[model samples]
Target chain A: MKHACKRVSQLTSDSFERELSLTEKMQLKLHFAMCSLCRNYHQRLATMAGIFEQMREHDLNQDIQLPIEDKQRIQSVLEKEK
Target chain B: MVDKQMNPKLWLKEHGDYLFRYALSRLHDTELASDMVQETLLAAWRGHERFKGDSTLRTWLVGIMKHKIIDHIRKEIRHRDISDRLEHDPTSTYFSENGSWQDSPSAWRDNPEALWDNQEFRQVLQECLSHLPEKQRNVFEMRELTGDDSETICNAYDITPTHLHVLMHRARLALQTCLHKHWFGGHTKS
Candidate 1:
């Protein structure tokens, strides 16, 4: 009884990374049926994953450029190699 | 014969920005990211003679950079703050001894999806990410940003799937709490 909520929340997180077993699926649905807090927890996890996805896309365009000093330093290293 | 694409100058000129961003995403330090790109170019130069042209030059350079990034991650793990490593269990006190919620997650008044466009929300998210424990932050960022399959990351980090899941789960929980507090106005006691 004590382990029920914690385990359900963990399984909810697990659902993102891998396929949950039928048992897990049924267990989560059943728990979610009875517990709104657990439902909120699961929903929040999904929402958070969505936020990260958005951030990743944003990072693709927003990345900072290589510093001029670093570029000069890399060129010197290449010349030394030559 | 050196592939024209393999010329170190070409790499520096063309792929430098891409490589720097890639390393920066993983390392989260401007200096370290730049160092990795440079190191990757040097390694590629030394080893280009052995190149079989099995992959695109960019792919090959990324391959070298991946190794360098992983190597640095290993060192970073060793030097990670002792306190940060000691307790990343974001769930501590989240539940009672009975594993029941001491205080369960509360309703978020606004839809998080709708708030994605809010610049403040984005800033808050970044702040939450920085608050994560060093290793957990690295692993979470690697997993989220790269979109690489779990197996590849587990093998690279020498962590089992269960360990990976635990690290990711805890990190997400921490982020969720932080965002709820700062962005959503639901206070989470530190």
Candidate 2:
């Protein structure tokens, strides 16, 4: 609802990716104390990141096949490198 | 990097196919993915002494291939147009006002469980990936799926770091909106 609150909400996403500046962490904590919208926004960002992480883990475990020619090509390349 | 004592020929014989498949999933191009995989092994051979085996050799090989894919994308960017716009305006009946997993995007998001359970998620994923423009898909698969750094991705896609950010932002926005429609649009859990 306030200018500080909006900036604080933005910090939630930024913070999830990396460490927040001391000022950012303080500003967000202050805003989260008073702003429900920013709190919900922060929750949503965390939820989305969590869901995406699960999707990635799902992808890594999926079985797949590589074509024969591509396999041979990689072998040749590695052999040349050796 | 493969060890010096490890014969390049023997190393290739042992791991080439696995590496090729790994690269193929990310690049989705047979010829190019192969070339990149080859380059990765070559780079590994040249840089073998640097490999302290902190992880498995397979992990090391994958790290090299990932860089190679980025390098390939950066080279390809010169031949194409680049845009950071989201494609959310595609007519869809299954989305809410905010494009949640509600009203209008329902058609696309519906029945994800069936797809997931049947291993058809892979098929649906491939279809969705095919719908993306090549560069956008590459950026999505590399950054979002493969855990590549933005700077390395920027180098791979031949984009300024700023453009790379915009492209990635647009990609996730588009995918979230699209997937909401097809994967979760209207199913109230029973």
Candidate 3:
């Protein structure tokens, strides 16, 4: 049980990077069925991953326009370099 | 019809802000982001004769900026050894000796889709991300946001895959703890 919990935590993180093997997948499913605590942790982790993805998309379209002074500065610097 | 061959000055005026925002998103520093954009513009100016018009000028400029941004990140990572710093963080408290969560995570009050629409939530999230340590933030951003593969990320930072996983795990744990506090009205027992 001790090692099971640790493996569950690791498996939760590993899911993000790569596919889980059959044995690992079976272990996690079996653990989640009985351990509500681990189940909750897994759910929250997945939700956080989802939010991070959405955040990336949202920020890319955000209105964080560059300041005018910086824009002019870059322009002038480029002009000088040219 | 818009001129097919626009001047470098005109290109800056037309696409500079977009390019600046793109660089800023990845670099997370205004001065560095500005330098990347400047460098991109200079590169574009010097290589103007190679502009085949196959892609828009903005696309070409952004392509150049991406390389510059990656180069800058590689250089920055090479200057510091973050392994000890990352390992010594207090995130170990999140788990117990038995490997179970010390304080199990509670379900978020709002679903991800709803939270995405909530401007205040997004602002809090951005603040939380900024609060992460530099190396953790870089690793998290590169993997999650930029969608860089683990191998590329490891090579760029000169860390092994195992180390990368540890950094990423800690990063996610920290973000989860932070968002729980800010968005979910502090942690609730699961």
The CA lDDT of each predicted structure is 0.79, 0.59, 0.77
How many clashes would you count in candidate 1? 0
lDDT digits (tens) for residues B107-185 of candidate 2: 2323333444444444545566567766677776776566667777767666776556445544444554554444445
Better of 1 and 2 by DockQ: 1
Arrange candidates, best DockQ first: 1, 3, 2
Q: What is the DockQ (computed on Cα atoms) for candidate 1?
A: 0.64
The count of residue-pair clashes in candidate 2 stands at 22
CA shift at B22, candidate 2, in angstroms?
3.5
lDDT of 3 at A14: 80
Residue-level lDDT of model 1, residues B1-190, one tens digit each, is 4556668987898899999988887767899889999999999999988777888788989988888877776665556632234344566657888888876787665564566777767788788989997768877888886676787677656678988888887887788788877876643423
- DockQ of prediction 3: 0.59
What tier of docking accuracy does candidate 2 attain? incorrect
How much is the lDDT of residue B181 in candidate 1?
77
Candidate 3: interface RMSD in Å? 2.4
Q: For residue B6, give model 3's deviation from the true position in Å.
A: 6.0
Which ranges in model 2 have alpha carbons more than 4 Å from their true place?
A1-10, A60-62, A73-82, B1-5, B42-56, B85-137, B158-185
lDDT string for model 3 (B26-80, tens) is 7778887877777888888888888778887788888788778777777876676
Alpha carbon lDDT at B86, candidate 1: 30
lDDT of 1: 0.79
